[model samples]
Target: MHKLLPALLLAAAAALPVHAALPVADSQGEPLPTLAPMLEQTVPAVVNIFTRTRVPVQQNPLLADPFFRRFFDAPQQPRERIAQSLGSGVVMDAAKGYVVTNHHVINGADEISVHLADGRTLQAELVGSDPETDVAVVKVAAEKLSALQLADSDQLRVGDFVVAIGNPFGLGQTVTSGIVSAVGRSGLGIEGYEDFIQTDASINPGNSGGALVNLRGELVGINTAILSQSGGNVGIGFAIPINMAKEIMAQLVEHGEVRRGVLGAQAQDLTPELAQAFDLNAQRGAVVTQVTAGSPADKAGLKSGDIITHLNGRPVRDATDVRNVIGLLRIGQNVEMQVMRNGKPRTLNAMVEQPRATTVNGDKLHPRFAGAIIGDIVEGMPFYGKIEGVVVLEAEPGSPAWRSGLRKGDVIVQANRQDVADLASLRKVVRPNSPLLLNVQRREGALFILLQ
Candidate 1:
């Protein structure tokens, strides 16, 4: 009976048709498709950008000719110093000959050249660049060229597959595949308005301004930066989302500049300690550190220490999140903001205003206080101590503080025999004709002080 049962099972197995393993769909239940069609459609739009810049050479004082010293009093002679750099760009409009790239790629370049994938090389002229967003647009004199189509980057999600194409390390036309690591990542200090798409793609130096496309061959991001210690790809790469790039590109093409709305407020991230201290249920949102007087935020009744958690009903996870939303808004547009103050949440409407066009020349200014230069004692800073007094950042080289043996990072707790809590109090106590007596708190211990 057992032999008869085994024979029946074998006959049943033989009756079934032969089967082979087949590829299945992804987690979204979408079937996997060949990437060849996407790549074939997009690769032609990508171009390599080569730039040459001339910099002034600093001549050595020892190499100066004694005979020519009288005629040339200048310390250095101007010389043609050429610097070469490489990056990648994508053609946005073939008819208008417009190409988009990172501002850092072509900044200060005297000559720029674009190399197409089909062995065609063209000289490119810079139209405009916005260093705040790290975006730039260049123009070439060619029609009928391949151009790329932009996709809505706001629809992207984490774990979505993406492909990066660019010239990495001067190697032409390279491609790398990776998944979206994160979205709306900021505070990396990479750019002014950082709403970056974090990815694990192999992006290197020359890959900046290249294309980060989805499986549909649509441009979703522009490769901008990488977080690496060895100056090589370690999988942590960042890209400017296409939506932000498109907004800047349109402005650059039309007016040669980007105009961003500002609320005129200094913001800081809400730490877990601050969240607990303020009785916040969630450790999210940005806290207003300072509101500029007579600005949009001030006019809207936003004050310092107020925690902003939402804008237009959308969650503002941090200061960068608020900045990203405000920067994209147009001037005169009214936006709703939800703020938490004194353990209570409230909503306020604020009209966006134009940002100040002050040109910052990268100078570190020292605040003058009571005949001394002072700086704030920022929290969590690895400085001398945790006292609430202004530190002597600088001392006017040979001022009273310098002569009194007061050095930089010396925290001044008291001035004019009165307790000093901040720079404003220090300034008030240090009048021009008043006798200065400061009690300083050094790195070691507190010390009584007397300044002239």
Candidate 2:
């Protein structure tokens, strides 16, 4: 019996350590780590943006009551309609009360209200907005406010942890955790210039202009758009990089608008067939299909059929790259471009110019034709799969061409029973007072035309 008791005592001692190794308990039976530090750092810098626009309210012509007429007749002024929109913004400068947000958030707004985390709502005025970059800066009358520190977005990589905070659906101050899905995303056609940071964060309708912060609670991006058919988050979202946003914000605050430099060259993506024809090693970079006469590229000796591989030492990944880099350049600044001519890389220097605000000419007809303009079909343009025709460059507003549903950019392959190659051929076929039969191709589909 004494031997058995000794063995039992040893067994009991062995089990004691296992019980002591159990995790310590809290009130919720979990580890206690405070989120106050992160909240304190980022919350104060985030602000709620509310915008109001006044639209003209049209009178209901069906209300024939004398009482209604008498009530609304005193004011001969246009009836005022109020539309309210809401989003989020980040306080960039505490001293100047400068805030950064998406341009669409405050576009055409008559009034703006900024709500701080401290339960203070103040009036905000638009400093400036750039539609191309989708960035805007606004100002409020406040001093010594908490402003967020910006992180270098260029340092971020895929799989890095990120946090997104905003007033989604007006549900005051929501935070979501995510990982960086991608970087340097462009050609989304969402905005003119896109270098978006792709993430899986829960960015919703009201999340636009919200801050996308890193684990250190530093702003890295501004939440902008999401790819979801239902308009809600579905594990795919995009944000404008903070670096681009910062640049636009600085320009907006100083110049009241962004001045983008232009190269004045028409570019197209190198298709696989074009790559084979040009004998390119890779189907990358933009192909200079045409250079506008007297433009910067033309003056710099850039010619058609040249492939632009680099701009100012940065790699031109695609057509978007050329646009984005050029767009950020200052007007009259000299920029260096690397082009591939005859399979040899050569450098050229060109002075950038301000982009003209001219409308795109889609009509491809001669001006002498009544309300018609002609354009030659440029090969290698992205026509929706397997369709080919000469594009329409212009159709005078309310002219015979306009009434016949002849839109700009429509491809006219056959006009007046003649295959149109260029403007001269089109003019030769269609005579004045002659009935014209045409066949047009559009992005959506094709159309048959008749003129009398």
Candidate 3:
């Protein structure tokens, strides 16, 4: 696409004004092809957003201890200050003044307001938001408003002409034009579920939650992030495809959160090295690294060493794609998957289920597991190779476990110098009135704690 795209873009740019009326002049008196007609329909739908948030400053952990805290006047709950941010939004429903933007734009906002193309500003009430997809919806009380048309993002193709409308660098409303550089771009670490529409459009810091539209003045994507080392646009920008945003918006609007199905499996990308080692013809697929026993995948006969090639007939590009497809599926829905086993493709069926929290009775493991649900890594709880230990599924705030310095994601590897490999062994070791010693490990690292 590298060489072919430039020629196509040049042809498209050359043909832009020949179909329409003659040239015109802008405020600077420079001869410019009239984009006013197109911008008129879309620019009004794009609104400026300002938000104010109050966040507490983090305090040192030592200051939280009773004895250490007594050394000083209990440090008043971390001081909070108002943080203000600005962005852009697209009005999707004119009658209701429903505006869609990135979740991060309105997250933790104490107050949100929308400034229209005219000299009017209205307070906006957050309707819903989904952090996983970084999409959000907010509504304003208004009667006569302009809304943009939403195009089927799935129909967008590479090199398609597109424009980004937003307040770049807080310079009011600005429009930049570029062609779609790529599609289905994933593994960018921008959001939990990423199926982005890549474009060369000039998106900047304040452009978050703005609109990315096509020639027909149809909303196709939401301007999100740009790949830049100097924090400036480098002709590489990303947008949340409107189709994915639409689906997430619907669930957020109705349920106030997104509910995704669990596959009970951990997978890795199908790299060229692994693909060759597995003797597969194509190098694009997700390889199962681990599958929990009796899980949805296991009940469907999936096992380690299976390469997932497709999900519900859609070709799986990598582990992220597999996750994207499954995470969007409704719970209890039957999922059809295609896998390559022994160099041959086979079909497997499974019912998408929500991962159940498996726990053991922690009454006896008081002060450590008391008021907490403890469990072994059995079904779909994230575990690395050869990691065997009891995990705390849930812990009450200020509970015995929390007081004893055990966190929710921490894995208890050793207790009282004894390796607590499983629940039975952990139960056998923890005793009452004994000085407790615990070795906990998280993604950050491991530490040893002594509890009296």
Candidate 4:
């Protein structure tokens, strides 16, 4: 009877005329809660992004053979095809027609078009993009565009109600509701700098670069990646905080690239054994391991054995936290770090420094390395302080180094079966006329290249 009474009451309430005003309850004593009002103002700001990319078509190895090509009279020019993909973006500045989206959305794109909720499609120009943070900005010439207000994402709590607005599966401006699952998520390997705001907000493939807003219709995050094995939404999703995105966007707009600052030190996560060694009771921090001489860290009096607890007033949980915080700051910015030296808390101020890589021509090292440029691994670079090796900064196409399977961004960790930690060590191992062997660390994996 109780269930039936509730159903009857619900049916009676349904029969009542719907009012424009919505609250927890109406004047007739009926419960009615809705997200319609908030979504009405937020959806228009979210745009649909379509990209067309021209990519080379792969051919069989036999087809590339000179003998086979001569016999079969294969086409001289390479075959190409156009690939199309869809994603979402947010209208950050309606006046300037600036739309912010994920870098992967328009990466390698030949043409980009933005579709508005008002049935308008405008061509967009790439303003700039930072692949490390996966943040990109595009400009479109449009009118009457709506923009969402940016909210303080740092103030967001785990239980705060949030809404995800995007064009999911090309369905056009879909809205999903969820609460903040977590904040300050890092070490995901999804991006170089990952301080993601994790949420269970049904973020899917086409939802990338969409807007994640709070209940007040204010933007808190930009939906970026999902953690689903089946490519479907399994409730686990991640977004770049608007605060972080805003900084990256500013640098991209100003310099067309991110000039990341460095702390010039290496640190590892604080372990229980290390905590005991340092006589510290807490486990959440990063222990400094090395400080480069004449660097910002060295100038600021940072030393090995110091455990960093906080940066710029925020708690540092591990090495990744330290990396992400410093990676986002621009050059010449001031940083405040709180560390424990000799079991005593100490505060230090340091200015972020511009990173410089010591580069050398490959011809000076070996004949096979001609036309390649090798550089010392500097702070703020990938694998900096994590690996000891010289990096191939550039390798010209059709050059001796390129023919020897050496490409740019390859870290040569070993030469002639001997450890080559830096350029000087590499020079000691490689003889001019002797056969050369290199153990290189590529982006995907490691391999050995032998040159005669």
- The worst-scoring run of ten residues by lDDT in candidate 4 lies at 17-26
* Model 3 vs. true fold: TM: 0.73
Lowest summed lDDT window (length 10), candidate 3: 377-386
Question: Which residue runs of candidate 4 sit more than 4 Å off their true CA positions?
Answer: 1-28, 58-78, 395-400
What are the RMSD figures for all models against the true structure?
Answer: 11.7, 9.5, 10.7, 5.8
Q: Tens-digit lDDT track for model 1 on 156-254?
A: 999999999999988999989999999998867677688999999889989999999998889999999999999999999999999999988988988
- Clashes in predicted model 4: 0
The C-alpha TM-scores of every prediction are 0.68, 0.71, 0.73, 0.87
Clashing pairs in 4: none
Candidate 2 or 1, higher TM-score: 2
What is the C-alpha lDDT profile of model 4 across 1-452, one tens digit per residue? 67799899999999988875546788998877889998889999999999999998876788878888899998664778899999999999999999999999999999999999999999999999998899999999989999999999889999888899898898888999999999989877788788899999889989999999999999999999999889999999999999999998889888888999888899999999999989999899999999999989999999999999999999999988898889989999999999998888999999998987688899988899999999988887768878899999999988999999999889999998999888989888989899999999998699999978
Give the per-residue lDDT digits (tens) of candidate 3, residues 1-452.
Answer: 79999999999999887668644777899988656789988899999999999987776788767787778767655667789999999998889788999999999899999999886899999998987788999999997799989999989999999999998877899999999999999867677688999999899988999999999999999998899999999999999999888887777777777777787887889999999999988889999999988789999999899999999898898887877787777679888999999999899999989766557755566555677788875433335333778887777777776777777767888988899877888878887667778888865589986766
Model 3 stretches with alpha carbons more than 4 Å out: 1-34, 56-80, 358-452
| Candidate 4's TM-score | 0.87
Candidate lDDT (C-alpha), each: 0.82, 0.81, 0.85, 0.92
**Worst lDDT 10-window in candidate 2:** 358-367
- Top of the candidates by lDDT: 4
Clashes of each: 0, 14, 0, 0
Indicate the residue-level lDDT of 356 in model 2: 47
